[model samples]
Target: MPRFTAQELDAHRAKVTQLLDKPSIKVGMSTCGVAAGAVLAFDTLVEEAKSKSANILISRTGCAGMCSMEPLVEVCIPGQPAAMYGNVDAELARRIINEHVLSSQPIVERLVPSIEALAVAYDKSDTPTPPGASGPRQYRIVLRNCGVIDPESIDEYIAREGYQALQKALSGMTSEQIIEELKVSGLRGRGGAGFPTWHKWQLTRDAQGDEHYIICNGDEGDPGAYMDRSVLEGDPHSIIEGMIIGGYVIGARQGVFYIRAEYPLAVQRIEKAIRQARAAGLLGKNILGTEFSFDLEIRLGAGAFVCGEETALIASVEGKRGTPRPRPPFPSVKGLWNMPTMINNVETLANIAPILVRGGKWFGSIGIGKSTGTKVFAVTGKIKNSGLVEIPMGTTLREVVNGICGGIASGRRVKAVQTGGPSGGLIPEQHLDTPVSYEHLQALGSIMGSGGMIVMDDTDSVVELSRFYLGFCVDESCGKCAPCRIGGTQILRTLNRIADLKGTERDIATVRRIAHAMQKASLCGLGQTAPNPILSALRYFEPEFMERIAAAKTARKEPGIARK
Candidate 1:
């Protein structure tokens, strides 16, 4: 409600941080949390707090990545440890208010260690702690404020050093200096490609344009991928601040957030964050009382997967059909009304704030070679702790599957792991010990696509999984090119035959030939990577396909015998 200068903002952070000295109650209110009945629990806590006349602050924050235990509630008393409870409801809310808030006695049955506390434990141990008994250690950097701060309140974000990065850039650093810091930090685009963020920003800045634009690609279409959505919902201001810093570096005066319409909650939170930011002198004219000025608006996408591509995203933002064009004159040169445009995904923008606050060298020293900083993954499917996990880049698949996610839900052997959604390939169980760097995932015939990791157990069939992913690609393909449109259909047919236990070696060979053509001839990323799932399945699980074919032959030989 008040416009703040640079000095005033700092003073306000000190005042807001003092509130932590008192008891506070925070409810997980993001999409995952709300779906698990967090809304009812939140209302109950507010009502019960009023009835009991409890002197506590009740607030709602974004998901902390543990979606398996939703309707989560966190309580922090002065002397006692901060406790997080999952699967909370109205009844639990009442008990928490009366027993935990009023009496200061924590409910052991519902208590889970805070992520920050667990990080301390992890730092002290050589071996990572396994999931289930304790939630996995998620080395959070981009998700530092998620599930910790009230997303609706700008002050909470500021208290945690949110816009200070933007302040430093606007008041102190030049555009080139910011790009150089990003380069030194080794920050890459988190939107599947792993391209250098610094290079893109530099190119956009150097491009010829009187007016430039910055676009935040929040249209996360990858199935099982919700990292971008959570960031948008839980820490919208981080993206805002990141964009402001980006706008300053790129010399862009206007920005746009291209989020899909399906994520209504994310859109709403972002819109609210934009308004709050404007009121606080963080978004509009003369931000932080500096000469630098920037404005932002939201553009709802139609849930097209191809729009995730830069050219298609730019076209969609300009009110054109969402399809990818040739890439000779990329978006950096001529984009969005024939002006230079710099586009980064939600997670990529979120990293900018932290990188600026902590020097580039500090971030660069965290992760392994070339892949610095933490990566947030939406780990789902047949896993005990199915939720979000953020670990350093060099962490092994074994650590993620066995330690963080608690191996398999059914306690069965792992069949394979799927990363990058429809576009990514499968990593067999044999490679579980492999580290999860971008190059390593690519070497394993998959990619680090937008951080969607689905763990599969032995009960699952690899051929069927490949078919399903290929089918999704076929259905979602933009159909702008023949290689992706027709090749995807042919690959899907071969996969269906193999999955049905009726494919021969010739059929397999035909599919492989088609896959290679699509990979080479497809116009955009959608077509080029559409056959990844099938190719990886064949590469790692060809024996299974042969076994199915043998069974089909035996069934045909014995007319009266039923197929096993």
Candidate 2:
């Protein structure tokens, strides 16, 4: 591919936009989909389309974020509503081809509309309902390309206005201009903490360092979270482009993706994307024939949860054991090889290109205050349409759980929603109406940690759920610090005692006390928030704990003692 200047790139973007007039079918082929046999379905559609000489375009994309309904197949035929079919098997694939592709008739019963569809539907409806009138609707910004384009192929991504963001950033904007745009956009770090993106870039940019490195955090160890994985698998280039843009801003020349080895498909796609980008002269020295020189490589993680932390991630990249060190000399100050570094999660980086392309204010205006831009959530656990969902920030849990997720499966009452993985807290039904912003979630005792929202129904026990997450933290604890290693273990033991119906009220108080201390004194985030699940559970479900204790007391007494 020949390098194009700014005007030429704009012309090419217009050309690409015209090509989108053609119809297509996109299959959600991420890990969630593959686990539900989407690969076979993808193959079946390709094979059948070829055999029957169907003109329909069959393409494989990443997860749409609705995890519970894996094997999602989206059909888009001209003048017909685009529809997504979930829980699709080979037989269903054949039916989708026959009914939707060939006949152009939408399979309404199997159809789950995209957020775009919801917006359109809302506009047409007489009642001024929020988008996603048929069910629930969410806006897609961070995950704009996921489940919409083939991740492994750069051409598919470019065809859908993918690298256009990078071109816009490189050709039209200066580093300071780009950083200022980010500040205006109100974008924050998606890797937990919710730090402003522009401020992070400015810090590294201003920090004294001739050598700088940019790391993409793909070590997603959150138990029910796969948002990062889906982004990596579905739209790897968005991240690559985002990283490149980040490198350009921070004056960094090298980029590394610290991805966990567990996501073989994500790893494979990213590797392929890097090779494609380099071949296209989008990576390596003097990108797009510009003076900017940036190169990227992949570093596999050993699947340690703590490695998700920036310092530990840096350590793992440097061929050391993945262990976090003390902050103050933050990664921005002294990171990998003790040079200045800027680290962003896969999802956070994915947003960069779009923010630059559309301008910061455009991106910022979509969501609620402070929490600008869309967030991609891996909605799992007991929901009917569990998958990856990207909605604009400030969308309520009620809209997400009841509307988009189709509520708990089989009309079950939703018990609670768990966000931020094991280190995050649970929000009971009373707070369902609360809008999901960084502040609102934190106020409700939950942080939006990497957008892992696990919805639980009546069938789930709050105590059991807290114990499960606490147990996960206990196992994944690096043990480098006493707070995480020892305190996490103690908290788990207390929660286990409660779950096993062997606890008193004092035990609840003890759990809270330990959680407070861990939060205040722990060496790292792992140690600090390790007790979140326990404390949140105690705060929201104290009655459940009391019931367990009462039951234990009843079970311990003899029949004669009970009579007395």
Candidate 3:
């Protein structure tokens, strides 16, 4: 209820830090955690603590990049590192409270290791890489506060140095200085395009427009990707801080959050954070008693994957059908009702505050080449440790699959990993060790996508996977352009025919031709990249297609009574 001032931030942070030193139990209560009975766990902990008269603070926070471990329960005692337990239920929560919170002993058998604790073999190498981004306690950088702090608690977020970047930017730095910091940080857009963030801000700032707009694209409809949703649910304050900084840098009075309607919890948490921010003197007119004034609103997407594209997203935000328009006058030049607009991905915006807080050079030094800063991945499908994994940009696919995800869950030989989403290509097993970057993944016929890595094993068929991804794209196609609309359908048809065991080499050529046409002539990114999955399949597993065609040929040979 009390408004915050820049002068009072440090003293409040120190007080909160002291409060965290007491005994506490924190539950991972994001959507994944909730589905896995996190609410039951939290309830059990509260009931037990009350029954036992235990002096421990029971709270709920966001996923710690470990969705598989939910409902995760963490117990912290003064001067001791928090111990995390996974797959918790009412019984487990009670046990955690009794053994860990009341007494000092952890339930050793029920404990789950941090992401940094695993070092599974990658590509049969003696030395396997770790998803190294943080210290012994938790994941660092963009996801720094994610499993550690309660999303709805503004004080906890501030205690963890949230919004410090905005205060720093507002008090000390100019718009050009902030852009220069981004340039030094080498931060590129993480919305799958790899465009430089600083350049986008610069262009939007320089564009001649009476009004400038900022947008966060949270419409991550990728099948296995939930990076944006998690951040919005877990650490909404950080993003609010990031957006305010972005608005200040680009001289925008307003910002928009275009999130998918499927993410109810994310929507709830972000809305709460926006209100908290406004009440805390961070939003609306004259924030921090400075000239900068910015406010935000939420726009729900109808689960359309194509809206992830900038122009299509703009159209959707304007209450029209979600579709892409031509790109001659890019969004930076003219967008959102012909005003200069800067749309940043959720993950991209999450990085802004961190880059400003910890010097830009420090962030740029972490990842390799132009791919600076860490990326958050929604690791899923056929993997032992399926969850969220945030690692440096240059980390190998093999490392992500084996080292972080603990490789194939079925004990089958690791076959391939699908990066990007429905619009990304597949990386065959042979190239697993290749570094994961925009350029490196592209070289291996895959892409970094929005950071959805689906690990596939030997039992998984490339034809089937390709069919699945292409089918998703086809279903979600805006149908605005003939090439994407027709070509995607034709390619899906051929893949279906092949799966039905009634196709030949000629059919494969037809598929290739159609996919190429879709790529070259599709209206937006959805159409342009719809062929990625099939094209990558053909590039890596054409022999599988041949095998299927050979089976059809054999079936027709002398065994059949009639040939067609």
Candidate 4:
């Protein structure tokens, strides 16, 4: 294989752009799409294209983030505008081939242009608020490629300016320079904790080790959270390129993707991307004809939520039961078979390529203070436009929940917005204007965890919601420490009693006490923020609990019914 320099890479990218510029039909083949029968649609498209002898390329890409409109298909004819058709099945796929592909007509009812496209369309006109925007403001720094390109094909990724960052970093920038750039970008760890990425890289870079490693944490276990999964499924190459750039910056010789086995499609696409990179001299020795010899491997997690923790992930990669160990000797100091390793989440790594290509300052200016760039949110639950929405940081909760997500479906009053999955907290309607930054969310008793935002309406019970999150923590807790295992279970039981309207005020106090202990004493993040939902709900919706308690008391006072 021939190695390409920076200029050569750009030229190749231009060529790919020209190829994609021509008329074509695109299919969303992400897991959601497949679940909605996208495979049959894809097969039908291929068959129709073959039968008609059309020269269009029938390509498969990752999730477009609008999962509610699954089986999405994008048709871009030479003369007509590109259109996205959602809820596409085999019938629609065939119609798309006949009408959009063969003819110049677009399917008007199914057209859902991307937010970026919408922004461009309304650049001169008044900026119309999107469908839902009740969540916090966010920027899409890490999740730029998700739902934007064909993840399965490297050429498609290349056409969209992928791998250019790797080329730039490897060809022009040194390891120290790359680290400095990341520092300037103020990029923080996206894997729950908001640790500075540069510091982690620098620690591993300075650590005394001949053999170093970089791992992408793709074991996203938060229920209702699928940001990592979407990125892995939609733009596997972006993550791959980010890992390569990370390896180059940290002077690592090897990289590993620690993804959950439950995400079979994500794992499959990532594996395919790795193979393609290797074949293209992007992985393995002397990449791009440079002295940077970085190699990568895939390590599947056996569906253990604890493995999402860095130490536990490293242990799992070493072929052990996924469990967390104490951290003072952090992963940067000793990790992944006792080597100096730097672990970054899939979203964090995906941002690396863009940061390198568009300078660090360029990224830093996109969001609010300290928190730079865009964030991709998996906005689900009680919303009309449910899927992924990427917005700049500091975007208000109201904007995300109401404008982008179209507010609560069917005009129901939004009760709260749940951010950060089981490990996150619920933000009441009163705090809808809160800016979505790591610090802002932390102040509201929440964290900007892998960007999962579940909208809740009036019908949703706060006590029940808290119970659900607490229960998840109890189940996924590794049980390595008592505070997490015991305290989590205790909190769950108390919340359950409250949900069942059988608890006194004392039980609520007990829940708070246990949550505090777990927050303070738990070994890892899973246990630390396990009580976030409970505490946040208690803070904002104490009336809801009091109402339930009052109802229980009223029942007890009336007749022969006994209250537990």
Candidate 5:
């Protein structure tokens, strides 16, 4: 018998409904908020509530983005507006308990303007909403449970209709039916490549293998990017459920979560969730009392950027040095000890449960064109509101930068917006109006790689920017591939010369030649896209390179700027 049956789950949900019905105070206690003193705020809120004898529920949830405004605290009264506060400290937390919870008077100055006015703007879109929505700042699906449910509480996840999708999938759908549904949804892999997800699952299902595996790629190593980490830390169960459903569909007997060791809290929470899931009969053999049986375990990566690649990750998990191997025998056909393996990143798996719950057509109707769904972007750089922003895929880059993130905070013109981490190209401000679809971004000489978006202002140097991204790839290269190793280092040297205003025009040509060579000859995606930033700088901001070299003699020579 399963530890949690359908009736038991329904009972738990009903009990949770009563818990949520009361006035509640929730604190953003994810890594971002905790770094900003959310732990103290949570403690203070609890203490103040106890002392005041307030009839309110005090709990903790994950980051709601707006990391610049954390630690955030939200007070939801029975019928009044949900008063969300930002930049909250222990003192502000106490005042919130005393004034808002105890006395019922909101502190207006502390209210988060967007949440207060547009209350349902970021609500869990439990039902399918319109697709071409630039009117609202965000429409969340993957991030629906984040910042709303307590990360440690399984009951809270259950209350939000969590494992229902897994049950629905197992009971009602065949493997082929599920794949067809995914085909209808048009859900592409969020892990940079943008490969059609249904096609990958289909490949894995059809590939002849006695044993199959499902792996969640949580080795997020991108600088200033926390979209995957945030999802892993916030809504871990969703990833677990998605993996379980995937394991059922792929006829896999096991699932693995490959997370980085650097994410201690994420690791801790996912570990706890796995234990809870196994105990509750959501994992292990005969899941939820069904004939389908699957299990999960966690493996930690040693912070290798290359391990984020599937082959490299598979190699690392097999006790080999983390490195990429040549692909044609992709992981789908031959992976993880020569068995069929399906790998999807944190964001892609998080979308699975939601898609299954609401039919595929419902999901496909959300975003514009072929890009059908919302994307979670780790918004950082010189933007006003720096943090996580999950907007529909069709939303224009201008809507994200100017409308959602509130433009450049320094009052300087945006020079470019860099997407897809170090492997991505820079989109000049003039092209910001383009929608954030896979094709749209590729046309602008950039990929929607893993959703790491960085906003750069006019004061930022294109030469230095190119050098920094190239420098990162050069350092992170496993050195197993010659083109990436040599070409990346060579391109970095040329950028250094330009940044120091000591470059000949020939240096530009040298950088371009080496970059193209790397793109064509690299062994893996790491080397192939390593020169993207440099190539992008050359493509859109070539004059900056020429002007610096042209004025090298007349302009005062300055010391090479140290890498921060």
Candidate 6:
């Protein structure tokens, strides 16, 4: 591997910038896109381009966050703007090559209407009427390069000022300076807990150990969340760059990416990024002609939801069962291999490079209050424009649900907005104006979990939602402790009884009782937070549970069923 000076990196970035200048066909090949048959669309584009002898570049990019409109294809014609089309199949891919690629006509039916204004300058044939000409503008810090550049291309990443942060950190800034920058940024963990990132780094830096390590927690198992996966797939180099900066800041020479095996594309891209970084001398010994050296390795999790917790993640990386232990000696104090460690989630790490590139104060000034910076949400379920949308922290639920996501689908009235996945709680529609800060959501009985915001309309049942989420938690419990394992199952059983027309007030009481025990006595976060959905549902929709109980009483008095 050749060691690169800053000048050489700049020279390389200059060369990579020209790749996007030519007419190119960039396909979104993230997991969502792949699931929607993007592989076929990509292949058809390549074959058709070759057959037509077209002077166009065929490449793959990551998800544009619009999972609902998968198999997304973006066309960049020479001397024109780049237009994105959705729901692209192989046949549509052929049309994209023949009609849009060879000719100037864009297939209006497949075009994602909201972004047309940003990409419609090239089509001088006719003024095409956009479906919905406007939408809430998204602030893209973590997701700036997503769906724009090829994830597997290191040069493309460098072209976008990617490794410029690493060069700055390694060549000029001291470790303490970097930590102070993060402190100034006011960045909190996006992995539900909302812990201050800089404080964690400072603790690990101050902690004495024989050797230090850093871990990137990519085991994002939140049901509706794919923010980390998309970032890893869309902009792998950003995460790599962030990890490298973190390693340097904490004085750790080695880092580990604890990603789930289910995310094959993310794992593949991260591995490729690591290999490329190592080869380019951005990783390994004495990075960027400095004495500081850091390396990264990938560790796959077996799809355990609990492993998203730091202690459980550390345990999983150490070849042990993915269950957490007590945490007085936190991971920062004693982590993997019994050394001081620093762990950051994928989104938190993604923010690192940007914060360094454009000073921390600039990042801090974006969002309101203590929650500074934008949050990348995997907006899914019942929303008209469901995809990945990154908004500033102080943004309200009304802005996200109504203004940005284009309101509820089918004109149905929204019942509640579920954030934080199973670990988090529900926000009733009445509180739509609540700003999406960590403190606000926590006050509403939900945590700002790893960016999974599942919207629910009137058709969704509160009891049913609780049951489904509880069932998931019960199934994913590591079973190392009794509170989570036994309490989770018992709560599920009680919820089932309520759903089955056989519940009583006593059953609901039992749920609260057991939930209290789990919350207070659970070993890990899984146990501690597993009852969140159940408790929050009980808190917000108690009438629904009571209605079931009242109906059951009425039925018992009328039928052959005996009253106990």
Predicted structure 4: lDDT: 0.82
lDDT of 5: 0.86
Candidate numbers sorted by TM-score from highest down: 1, 5, 3, 6, 4, 2
User: What is candidate 6's lDDT per residue for 206-294, written digit by digit as tens?
Assistant: 99998899999999999988899999989999988998898888889999999999998899999998999989989999787788889
Instruction: Show model 2 residue runs off by greater than 4 Å.
Output: 2-19, 95-100, 103-110, 118-136, 559-564
lDDT of 6: 0.87
**Candidate 2: worst 10 consecutive residues by lDDT?**
120-129
Task: Name the better of 1 and 5 by lDDT.
Answer: 1
For each candidate, the alpha-carbon lDDT, in order, equals: 0.87, 0.82, 0.84, 0.82, 0.86, 0.87
Candidate 2 C-alpha lDDT tens digits along 407-480: 98879899999999888999999899998899999998899898899999888888888888888888888889
Clashes of each: 0, 12, 1, 35, 0, 1
Cα shift from native, residue 464, model 6 (Å): 1.3
Relative to the unseen true structure, what is the C-alpha lDDT of residue 327 in candidate 6, on a scale of 0 to 100? 92
Candidate 6 pairs with clashing backbones: 65-388
**TM-score per candidate, chains pooled:** 0.96, 0.92, 0.95, 0.93, 0.95, 0.94
Give the range of the ten consecutive residues with the poorest summed lDDT in model 4.
Answer: 120-129
Model 5 agreement with the true structure over 1-564: per-residue lDDT tens digits? 237765676676787766666778888888889999898888988888888888788888887777899998888777886788998987888889888777778888888854434213323454333445434557778887888788888888887878988878877789999989899999999998899999999999889898999999999988879998888888899999999989988999988899999999999999999998888889887777778888898999997999988899999888899999999899999999999999998999999988898878888987778898889899899999888888888878998899878999988899899998898999999998999999999988999999899999999988888888888999999999899888888888878887787778799889888888999999999999988888888899999999888776445443343221
Q: Model 3, 224-309: lDDT tens per residue?
A: 88888889999999888888999999999999999999999999999999999998889988887788889999999997889999
lDDT minimum window of 10 residues, candidate 1: 120-129
Candidate 1, superposed: residue stretches over 4 Å from native = 120-136, 559-564
lDDT of 4 by residue, 29-87 (tens): 87888999888988999998899887788878777777888887877666666688888
Model 1: number of clashes?
0
